[model samples]
Target: MATVNLDLTPIHQCSADGCTFNASASCHAPAITVGDHGANHCATFLGIPTKHSPTNDGHVGACQLSDCSHNADLTCTASTIEVGTSAGGGTECLTYSAA
Candidate 1:
């Protein structure tokens, strides 16, 4: 399958409003990954967002959110998304949406 680099420069907020990593300007995490639906959780599987590009169909690997309700498919299904710093020290998403 062909790979397409996802532009993480668009996100500017974290879905988890209580997260400390979320700043008023941008995400505090060093890196982030696009969720199957939107952006809702840090990509810590490897402690960082994978370098793989998104597919044309918009499906990626398993999501990294440990507390997500739809974590079964490793995908997100929220209306909006949130950004924040990973558990370590990088930019990440705290919420996502399929819409």
Candidate 2:
């Protein structure tokens, strides 16, 4: 199988203990998608047991919230970001701001 390499740049700080990709306050996922289904939330978030402290840090691969000020060309331009729970459910980008 061919492995695809992602050259992610945006920094994503994941603080959700329930996320399988969170490791030592950092995100370990190869890439993470921000903005929920028609809402501001972390859609890539997955709840699982046995959290492993992965060495790789998470990157904001994409942002669907077109109204967010940090979004540019469908990508997140924030220098830093965080993932946390919201009233909707799961994780949401704490740094999200209106344009």
Candidate 3:
């Protein structure tokens, strides 16, 4: 038998408690995407009450912001990331920084 290892970046902390994937100040979506038309918003953030996750450990599966320093090949290379409400009044990747 063979084993595979995935080095996806984990979400450190998420303040979007209203999201279905959020629990205990963490994200449990398994994987999240960071990018909303070049912005640092979290595209995976959903406020609906369906499909809730049981775990609190989520990872960054993909990031569409190529201008971010932590993004590489559409993937987030940061060791961990934080998500929270943005100044524009939307869920965003708080760890985002211009390259």
Best by lDDT: 3
Candidate RMSDs in Å, in order, are 9.6, 2.7, 3.2
Residue-level lDDT tens digits of model 2 in 1-99? 223245454445666878888777788776778877668877888888877567556788889999999899878887778888776665888898999
* Whole-structure CA lDDT of model 1: 0.43
As for model 3, its CA RMSD to the true structure in angstroms is 3.2
TM-score of 2: 0.82
Candidate 3 local Cα displacement, residue 54, angstroms: 1.7
What are the TM-scores, per candidate, against the unseen true structure? 0.32, 0.82, 0.88
Task: List ranges where model 3 is wrong by over 4 Å.
Answer: 1-5
Error of 1 at 44 (Å): 9.0
Relative to the true structure, candidate 3 reaches a TM of: 0.88
Instruction: Encode model 1's per-residue lDDT on 1-99: one tens digit a residue.
Output: 445334323343444334343444334434445543444435432333333332232222345554666454544444335455566654555454232
* Model 2 lDDT, full chain set: 0.77
lDDT tens digits, residues 1-99, model 3?
222225889888999877989888888887888998987799999998774756547889899999999999998889899999976789999999999
Task: Give all candidates' CA lDDT scores.
Answer: 0.43, 0.77, 0.86
